[model samples]
Target: MAEESTKSWADTDSESSSSSSSSSDSEQEEVHYLIDDQTSDDEVFDFSNIEFTREDLVQALNDMVHEYKTLSHTFEEIKAENASLKNSSAKSSSDELEDTDSLKIELSKLRIENELLRSESSELKAEVEKLTK
Candidate 1:
């Protein structure tokens, strides 16, 4: 049993070595083919329409930068608008609080007037009873 195991292990190692050698050869061939294909592809790129002026590229970049600045300014304006709206809301809330206080004062005054009217009606009832008697 021990001898059989040893033989099996040796056979497996030999098989692995042979497989690795074959894979290495295939990889080298693939690398050589890729190098040739790249050279061939470089010959096919169309260079006729390629612009050589640095000024054109610079102009395009400047335009993009200007647009970016405009967008940034718009964002700042929006932020300022939001802050102004928040301030307006705060002012309105204080105004509403003042209005609520005014309403409370008016309610107290009405209650006092109602008590006075009830007292006057009771006095008039007493005077009417005395005259009838």
Candidate 2:
């Protein structure tokens, strides 16, 4: 069983190495083809025939300004929402602090009551002993 396991591991290692080398070779070929395609594509686009008019420039600028206004409005809304959430968080934190203080006060009161009960119990026990005597 041990020998079979070792043999399978070695086979897997060799298969992985061979697959990796094959993949690398295919990647190199793809890169070479991409380079050739890019050079061929670059020669096809003749930028000398393209023209830009004044109207086109004005339209593009107007579009940019409109988009900026929309974005600014959205940013202000998000900021207002963020401020509202921070205010609520602050209110809740103060409430939590008050609750913690109240709990601490209750705990101290309970401790004192417990001590009183213990002392009264000891006094009753002493009285019972005296009665028996």
Best by lDDT: 2
Q: 127, model 2: CA deviation in Å?
A: 1.8
lDDT of 2 by residue, 14-116 (tens): 7767777778788768866765666555543332224644344455556777999999999999999999999999999999999999999999999999999
Candidate 1 lDDT by residue in tens digits, 36-78: 6665556432223355343444555567779999999999999
Consecutive 10-residue window with the lowest summed lDDT within model 2: 44-53
Each model's lDDT = 0.75, 0.76
RMSD of each: 19.2, 22.8
Runs in model 2 deviating more than 4 A are: 1-50
User: Model 1: runs farther than 4 Å from truth?
Assistant: 1-49, 52-54
